[model samples]
Target: MSFLFNTYALARPALFSLDAESAHELTLKSLQKAYDCSLTRGMMASRPELPASLMGLALRNPVGLAAGLDKNGAHIDALGNLGFGFVEVGTVTPLAQPGNPKPRMFRLPQKQALINRLGFNNLGLQAFIANVRKSQWRERGGILGLNIGKNAVTPIERAIDDYLLGLEGVYPHADYITVNISSPNTQNLRTLQGQDELTQLLQPLQEKRKALADRHGRHVPMAVKIAPDLSTGQVDIIADLLPRYGIDGVIATNTTLSRDAVKGLAHGEEAGGLSGPPVHELSLQVIARLREQLGASYPIIGVGGIVSGRQAKEKIDAGANAIQLYTGLIYRGPALIAECVQALKR
Candidate 1:
């Protein structure tokens, strides 16, 4: 563990020197290399195995890598080596996209956070599924989630078409599917969260999932990813609607648009969702409220601003059935996974 921690510490300087997205690409490539060289086991020699389950899927542990980290499912095998119970990839659309623009990702070292408006840039559905099929992680019993989204060119009214296509394409390959309607980067994406729009979106997806389950002879659970920037009423409305629509779970609190926490910091006013410690409290609040409305049995994967084991545990305390990490991994490295698992064990 110390070796891995020290290794990342030594490498952080060089990686940080590059632009954020470039550093991200480099990190993924490096992980793939390390896995190919069979060195990840040494780095993660003591990964704890605290078996658990969520949304009917068995997990080795409840710590998962959230979506957006491996957008195209490109590094599932390599990332699975780091000891995540599950790894979710994509926000992939029905068609390929170049995303927003360069410099869409920013790092705020002083706050140990990142801001990204990458806008679901991905290699489209076919390429995404091909990459997922190439991965051996799921074959090795690692839970894999494929998060689906609509294309930028698709109008909000026609968004369901994109999601339905995404769902059908990814259903057989996924241990679970995440319906991502929360990213602030896409124009008016969050508008789908409205009461009527959400119902329209979920009904057809659930119906499609039912047909796919029968066709594939498997029942794959679907979870909705929601933003943290919602009102109490909004959260309550969603909670009431989810079970009614036959949705299996909810990933509470995607990145936040509020800059209240990072105000006056460099790049604080940037036009994108802010993630890291700044959104931690906001995420916890949403999880707590969702739990109040959804009850103990509903699965809630809490994410946002977890930078420590204590914060990871806090998500559970706030009523998350499981938790995911993204921004924290950027600041704390793989050690944070073991740390979070240990914290959960207690």
Candidate 2:
């Protein structure tokens, strides 16, 4: 494990030297090569044991790889082998897009966080499904959630159309589906969280959820991925609406626009949501608040700034059915996943 970290650290300088967005693309390309060569399979085959059950899906572990890491579903099998209990791909829109302009993603090394305004840069629904169909990873026997959203050009008022389209396309392929209404980069996307708008937006999706279940003879849970920037009032509203709309669970955060913890740092002023240590406390606060509103029965997936076993446990204690990591993986490597699962067992 330490050797992996050492090797990654040795390569960090080279990766960091490139523009953030470009570096991301290069990393994905490298991962694709690794997958093609079966190197990732050989390296990640000795999987850990950390089974968990949430929302009727049996996860191999409680720690999952969050969305954004595999925005196009290209590396599902490769990532699944790396010991994640589950993997989520995409913030996929109905149509493909190039996302925001260059220099849209930044790293705050000192704070162990990432700030990215990479607006749903994906290969669109048809292309994404085609990749999923071709991948050996999707059939690897683990939990997979399809995270859906609107295209960058779609008007906020009509976001549901895109989400529904995404649901229709990926519903059969995904073990579950995540509705992402909280990403801050897309203009006015977060407005869907408002009481009136949210209620209206969710109604049709809920209806489709039922229709799909009946049509396919399979029940795929639907979860809402919310931002950590909301106030208690907003959280309360969400809590009230979740069960009312038949939403299955909540992914406690989707990153934060606040730069409180890394203020004045090199990438502090980057215009994107920040994730890592800065959002840990706030993520816990949101989970706890949601727990209060929804009570112990509601399922919550806690994510943000969880780089250690103790941090993972803090989220569980605050009321998370499971937890996820993205920036932490970037900072600590795959060993952190086993470490977190082991620590949670204690």
Best by TM-score: 1
Model 2 residue runs over 4 Å out of place are: none
Please report the TM-score between candidate 1 and the true structure.
0.98
Per-residue alpha-carbon lDDT of model 1 for 130-239, expressed as tens digits? 99999999999899999999999999999999999999999989999999999999998999999999999999998999999999999999999999999999999999
Worst 10-residue lDDT window, candidate 2: 39-48
| TM-score (all chains, Cα) for each model | 0.98, 0.96
**lDDT value for candidate 1?**
0.93
In candidate 1, stretches whose alpha carbon ends up further than 4 angstroms from where it belongs are 39-46
Error of 2 at 207 (Å): 0.6
Q: Rate the local accuracy (lDDT) of all candidates.
A: 0.93, 0.87
Q: What is the Å distance of residue 167 in model 2 from its true position?
A: 1.0
